[model samples]
Structure formats: structure tokens, C-alpha cells
Target: MVFIYVLAAILLLIGLLLLDYALGKKHHLKNVRFLNFESTTGEYQIYTAGDPLFQDLFQDLRHAKKTIDMMFFIVKTDDISEELLEILKQKAEEGLQVRLLLDRVGSFRINSKIIKDLRESGVQFAFSETPKFPFFFYRLQRRNHRKITVIDGDIGYIGGFNVGREYLGKDAELGNWRDYHLRLLGDIVQHLQCTFFDDWYLATGHHDEEPFPTETEGEKWIEITATDGVQLEDVFESLICQAKDEIFIGTPYFIPSERLFKCLTDALDRGVNVKVIVPMKADHPLVKEAGLPYMMRLIEAGGEVYMFDRGFYHAKVVIIDQQLCDIGTANFDRRSLFLNKEVNTIIHNSRFVMDLRLAYLKDVQDSQPLKEHIFQLNTIRTKIKIGIARLFRPLL
Candidate 1:
């Protein structure tokens, strides 16, 4: 009788949580907003690893003249993060207008005491996309997955690198980390700053505006895109459907929506080269399995797939016809497409894209071609996991 009562209580609690999630998640995505897209020019340099990215970012923080603003999906508590915190603290003490916004659930491991310390040290810190009561369950999974830093008002850092040791390749399980980050110099920095402040306003109820950047000395045309989650598919679909010659995609996850999958298959049918690179080893359970069916279908359709064997391939990149490139925080997964707030920087053809192309080729060279036999479901357990992943694909 006691066991039955305990099970009943547990089930009741889950039902209440689900109800709360349904109510709270309705407004979660709508709450996050972005500035209007204004095309501009910027000089960009790509960083393929965290060591160089962080080293340059830290130095840039030290050199910042007026303000420092940052936002990230996750900020793991470790030595590397401590180093960054110390820098921000010291910079804050020096009277710089410093602000940090972290996704509440993504960085839940960061203790309240640390945040208090930052506040006391003059840093303005707040949690973004925090779930509220009555709808907490659904809202809790919604996230601000953008990673960006704007120094003073001239330099902008954007892409997948977050503040953590694992991002630095210190995790024993994931092995070396591979990603793409960009350091930008131009008016786009102002645009990034305005977007950061808009996110900050949503999180902290404070609002400020920065003017859009104008023409600069660079020849590269760029656009900063912020998505409230639902609109990303349209943007990506348009890009893919318009591809003339080839499509190159490198992402951590590959569970695309039905339309996206069809688009890729059609691209293959049109004889447009479509190549995708995914990590050989999955950092999360079932993610690799979830993509196996897609990979096999692509292979059946004459598409090429590469398994990045050198490390965890976390680069969220898409190159179309060597004329444009997208490098940002989004993955080729349903979660990114329909759930998380994302930011992507689009770069038009230039010498920069040519260099990025070379880097992409190098990454492909470091990977192994995905063979259908080696990856297709070979066991009941694997099939079961894939089945489970499919049921939760939207939340993956």
C-alpha cells in the first residue's frame, strides 16, 4: 500500500510539472528579440581553437576603453572560467561598464555566491531566459544559446566558444575541441552591442541603444542575424534552396527538420554537391544515433558525409558555393531550429571566405568518410535509443 501511494505521489508531481511547462513555455521564445538586420562591412579573423580565442579575448578586455558586454549559453565553473571572472572583476573595479548575461539553466552550476561576488565587485550580472512559475518546466528548456562579446564599441567576438575548460580541450572524454570563432573590427561591433543590450533588457529590465554601424574599411560584406527560434528555418531554407554548386555543413548535431532533410535530399538530386561533417564521437547519448538514419538517407541519395575523427567537431558552419558562409551558435538540429534563441553571422564572398574554405578543406581532410555499414543500427539497444531520440527530437 505504501509503495502504491509513493508511486501515485511521484506521478502527480510529474503531471503538475508538465502543466507548468506548457503554460510557461508559450511566451519563452517570444520574449527574446533582436535588432533589425542591417548589412555592413567588417574585417574578420577566425579562431579554430579556444586557446587563441580566449587569449585574444582576455587581452582585448584588458584593452577595452569604454565598456565590456558579454553573453553566453553556458559558463562552466572551472579554472578557465575563474581566470575570466578575475579579469572581469578587475576590469569592473577599474570603472569599466561591464555586464555579463548567462542562460540560467545552461549555467546552473555557477553558484549564487559567485554571482553575488561579481555584483559586489561592480559587475552587472544577470540570468537570461530564466523560467518562471506556472510554466517553469517548458520555459526551463528554452535558452539563449548565443555567445558574444563586444569590447568598447569597436571589436566584436562571436561564435561557439564558451567560458569553460572543456571548450579548451581539457575534457578527457570529449578529447580535443574543434570550433570556429570570429573576431570582428568594424561598425558591426555597434550592431552586436545593440543586440546584447536588447537581450540584457529582456533579462534585467534595463534598456539602452547603440546606433547601427555604417560603412568601414573592409571589403567583406556581413550581416548579423538573431533568431527568436522559429524563423531560423526559413533563413536556412532560403540559403540551402538557393545553393548553385555545393553545400558544406559542419555542425555538432544533424537532426534536421523534415523540410530541411527534404531540401538536402533535393539538393543531392539536383546534382549539387552536399557534404556534411559531424563529430565521430557524440558528446551526448543518442545524438549520433539520431543522425544515423539521416546520414544513411543522404548516402542513398548520393550525398557525402564525413565523420570528424580528430576531435569533437562543434563548428556551426554552412558554406554555399564558396560565395557565402555562416558561422554561428546554431547546429543543424531541430532544437536549434525551433527552440533556442540563436545568432549567426553571414559573410559574403571575399578573401575571408576563401581562407575559411581552405580551413574547411583541412577539417574535411582530418575526418573519415562515413560508411553506411559502420554506422547503421546494428543492435537492438542502438535502435531503441534512436527511437527514443526521435520522440524527443524537437527538444534535442
Candidate 2:
């Protein structure tokens, strides 16, 4: 009995040590300063108030000379999809190494003809592992929720935009979809490239031979950090906790982890003006149902919640203290926090943050306030549904 007790105590200590090490690494990366050019000079490219995201994406793809790598959760067969495919086919035909990674589950409805066409055009492709029962709980729970594209290892794009008509406001049922995507043209692009390569090799069992691009010394400095099951310290939660004065967050789904909820509540307690905007009508009813219970807590704690009435609010962004912004595909839910392989760009530029804030303001104008009365008025049946959703949120 004495030996067993000692062993248990030793195991507990080892677990604590590991947790400390993991959290320490996460904190270190969160605090790493990125050089913001706007701080030095009063000028920066803060593109807000409506920019043609697809046009920029097409231009970047058309200019790819050596390599084009892309990873996305979904790739619908739409106009944008066909245009992108044509550009990629042309690039591959020009001897450029083009690769695409799609999630098997998300793109399950995608026609096989499109895959055959791309493969016949010499574009290498692979599907992220599908969730299989009994033998693949890890793969089933953890998904590659990153939407990324890297061109020539110098230019990249990352954000919540998937390859779908709805994302570009081209779907009849999903009109005027609001989303965000960034065009990166510096050292951070390499980080995005590395992320794509890691996923590609994991899916296809082939690795790229090219050296990773080094950090480019530019006027603007940015760090791209990612989180997966491999690193389970909740990097996004840390960023939210670090917010001091204000936080403007927008996500389609807002079923937050406990750590993230505490962080936001603490920020509110510390007098941070916290505002969260979620879609009034989410594409997934389960996510919308799961998000309602948490709003009353946030509102009572001095935080504000709004539901976007403008079609679908699919973008995931957080502007912290009006100085730092994170834009990515990760939602504020258990899936993104603990299950999905998510990539978020930590931009320490005030200009970028301001731009994001402005966008949030516009989104707020288009949103309806989620008052305490709504929660009070829900019937018992609705409450039961919400309860079930909350119970299974981690799996959702």
C-alpha cells in the first residue's frame, strides 16, 4: 500500500510538471512581440469596409511560380471553385508543384469528377483522414479546420473562408455571407507553408524537399501560431485572457471551453468591454443551440452578446485590447479548442486591430442584441434541447 501511494503521488507530480511545461510554452509564444510597421509610421494597409477577397485570392494563385499549397475543410463545386481549379491546373501544367488537401468528411459531397479532373491535370491531392468508428476516435474528434493557401512560399492566405459558394455570397440559399481572409506577403507565409506541409505529409506520407522559408525582416512583423491535440494548452484561450481594455469577437459558433469562458468572464470582471457576435441563424443548429446558455452568464457578468442578422457570420476573429487581432477558421467552441487542428495569425499591429474593430462595429450594427428576456421566454422543450446540446458540445 505504501509503494502504491508513492507511485500515485509520483504520477500526479509528473502530470503537473507536464501541464506547467505546456502552459509555459504557450505563454512564451503569446508574448512574443511582432514588429508592427504602423507603430513606427502612421501608415499601414488596413483593408476594411469591403475588399474583394476572391479577386485577391485569384491574383495570388495566378502569380504562383514554383509552388501552390492549399488546405481547406470544404471545397464545393462552385464558380469560385472552378476558377481556382482552372488556375491550379494551369500552374501545374506550367511545371509548378501544386497540392491540395481537403477534409474527407467536409468534402464528402464534392463530385469525384472534380478530383479526377484535378489529378489528371497533374495536381497532387489528398483527403484528410475520415472519422472511422471504434478504431479512430482521435481522428474523428480532431479535424483539420485550417483554411490556408501558400504561393511560392512567400505569399499566403489564411482565415475562415472555405472553398464554397456560400463563403463568396454566391449560394442562393446562403446569400451575402460575411467572412474574412488575409493576404500575407512576408516571413509569416513560411509558417503557413509549413503548416500545409505538415498536414500533407500526414495525409499522403510524402514530404516536401524544399527548405522552410526563414523569417523575413520586414516593416511588419507577424507570428502565426497553431494548436492541435499535440499542443493542448488552449492558445486561443490565453490570447483572450491577455485582453486588457476591450475585446471584439465574432464567430459563427460560440460554444466556448471552460477555460475560454473563465478568461472572458475574468476580462469582463477586470473592466474589459467584451463584446461577442455570433450568427443569429447558424448553419449548424446544434452550435446555435449550444451557444444560448452561455450568453446569460456573459451578459450578467458585464459582457455583451449579439446575434448577426446578416445571412451567416462564419468569420472567426478576436481583437484584443484594440492592439492585437487573431483571424482564423477556429470557432469559439469545444471542437475548435480541443478537437480541431486550428491555425490563427497573431497580428500585433494596432492598424490591423483597428481594421478588425471597425469590421466588428459594422457587424454589430447588423446584429440583434441577445437580451436576457429571450432566455427567460424559452419553453421547457427548448431548454431541454439546449441542455442536450450543452451536454454533447465537446463532441459537436
Candidate 3:
């Protein structure tokens, strides 16, 4: 009789926990208030690895004259991060108006000593929506996953690379980190600066008093779509719906919501060639497991899936009909598509699209094509693991 009572109590506890989790997992895609698409001209430089990317960023930091704002999902305490901190400290001392906003959960392991030094040096910093109290438990499900940097209101960066040695392929565990980052110069950067200030005000409750650059017309068409958890899918669907030829997606996570899966299948039915690339060695096993089912469906629906084996493929990029390209921090997974505060750029330039296409072709060369039989080979235990992982995808 005691054992039965204890079992009943444990089951009740589990039920309540699931209910709490479900209540917090709200999909606000339809409610996302995307900033109006600003049409502008800009020069774009794509960075695939860490060395040149960091070099470009450091140069931008050094040359920044008026103000600097940075927001990232993760900022580690490694050499890369230390160097960036040092620059921020020096710039702040020089009166450059440096500010930083990081995600509390993403940078939880960052060293407090480094943070203290930064504050002592006059560098302003805050975490985006820090978890607190009863709200902390439920609010922890949401995250600000944008990676943005604006310097002098003239330059901007947005992509997957974070401030970490691992991102530079310096970690011993994860060999080489493959990712994509973009550098932009023009009036479009003002949009990035405005987005940064919007998030900064939300995090610190302080508005930026600095003046933004005046908008000017340029040579190429570019739109920066910034969205929170509520409207994450609007930009994606808007872009995908306009695809007339081919669609290429490269991301680390592949788990798709049913609605998005249906959209892709519909695209395939319309004779659009859809191809997806995902990391072979995932940082999260459960995330990888959750994606297998989606991969199978994509394969059966006349779409292609490629497993990137060169390294941990962390690039979130999409190319449509070789005419438009989107490069930013949002992945194809449900968390990135629906639950995180994400940012992406829709580049309407044929030259930029061609460059991304060349890179995608090179990546496909290093990847293995996934066939339908790959799913059939999974054992019962693996299938069960996938089912369990799917249940947790909402939280991931």
C-alpha cells in the first residue's frame, strides 16, 4: 500500500511538471511584430571560418569612432573572448560608448572575474532577460539567440559565430567549427544599430542617446528581419513562398515543426528542388535524434538531406533560386524558428547569391547524401530514443 502511494505521488509530480512545461511552450509565430522591411544598398562580405572573421571584426572595433554595440547568444572566456573584452575595455576608456548584451543562459559559464574587470573598465553590459524567481523557471524556455555587432553606426555583423575559442576551431574536443558570418557596410547598418538599441532597452531599461546614421540609397537590395519568439517564422515563410527554382538550407539543427514540414513538402510538390545540410556530429544528441524523422520525411518527399562531416556545421544559411540569400543566426529547428529571438538578412543580389551557391556546392561535396534506407536501419531502441527526443523538442 505504501509503494502504491509513493508511485502515485511521483506520477502526479511528473504530470504537473509536464503541464508547466506545456504552458510555457507557446508558439507566437503569427504574433511576431517584424520590423518593416527596410530597402537599402550595402556591401556584404561573407566569412566562413574564424580567423579572417575575427580579424575583420577586430579591425572594425579598432576603427570604430563613435559607438559600439554587441549582442550575442554566447560569449565564452577563452582567448577570443578575452581579446574582445580587452578591445571593449580599451574602447570604453577612449570614450567610444561601448555596450554589450548577452543571453544569461547562453553565457552562464562565463567567468565572473572577466565580467567584473569589464565593468571596472567602464564597459556597459547586461544580460537579455535574466531569469528570476518563479518566472525564472518558466521563462528559461525562451532565449535571445541573435548575434549582432554594430560599430560607428556604419558597419554591422550578423551570423552564427560567437566569441569563443571553439568557434575559432581552437578547442580539442570539437575539431574545426564551420560557421558563417557576414560583414556589412552602408545605411543598412543603421537597421542593425536600431535593432541593437531596441534589445538593449529591453534588457537594461535604458534607451540609447547616441545618434544613428542617416539613411542613404545604395546599389543592392537588403532587408534585415528581426523577430522575437512570437513571429520567428514570418520571414522564413515569406522568403520560401517566393522560391521559383531551388532552395538550399545549411544549418546545424534540422528538427522542423509540422507546419514547416508541410510547407517544404508543398514546395517539393511544386517542383522546387529543396536540399538541406545538417551537422554529422551534433553538439546535442537529443537535437540530432529529433531531426531524424524530419530528415526521413524530407527524403521521401523528393527533397535531399546532406550530412556535413567536414566538421560541426553551425552555419544557418538559405539560398532561393540562386537569386536571394539569407544568412543569420536562426536555424531550421523549431527552437530557432519559433522560440528564440532571432535575426536574419534577406539579400536580393545575384552576385551575393552566386557566391553563396559556390560555397554551398563546395559543402555538398564534403557531405554524405541521406537516403530513405538510413531511417529503416535504425533499431527499435534508437526509434524509441527518437520518440522520446521529439517530446522534448519543444523545450530544446
Give the per-residue lDDT digits (tens) of candidate 1, residues 1-396. Answer: 999999999999988977776665566555645457888878888999999999999999999777889999999889989999889999999999999999998989889899999999999999998877657677777788999898877789999988899899988988899999999888777777777888898888897855434334665789998887787898799889999899999999999998999999988888899999999989887788888889878888998889988878999999998889899999999879887888899999656777888888898999988874554557888888878888677677
TM-score of each: 0.93, 0.83, 0.93
Instruction: Name the top lDDT candidate.
Output: 1
Candidate 2: where are CA atoms >4 Å away?
1-51, 132-134, 209-217, 230-233, 372-377
After superposing all C-alphas onto the true structure, candidate 2 shows an RMSD in angstroms of 8.5
Please, what are the lDDT tens digits per residue for candidate 3 over residues 136-169?
4456767889999998777889999998988988
Q: Quote model 2's TM-score.
A: 0.83
Model 2 C-alpha lDDT versus the unseen true structure: 0.75
Error of 3 at 71 (Å): 0.9
Off by over 4 Å in 1: 1-34, 211-217, 372-376
lDDT score for candidate 3 against the true structure: 0.83
CA deviation > 4 Å runs, candidate 3: 1-9, 22-34, 209-211, 214-217, 372-377
Determine which window of 10 residues in candidate 2 has minimal summed lDDT: 35-44
Candidate 3 minimal-lDDT segment of 10 residues: 24-33
CA error at residue 379 for candidate 3, angstroms:
1.8
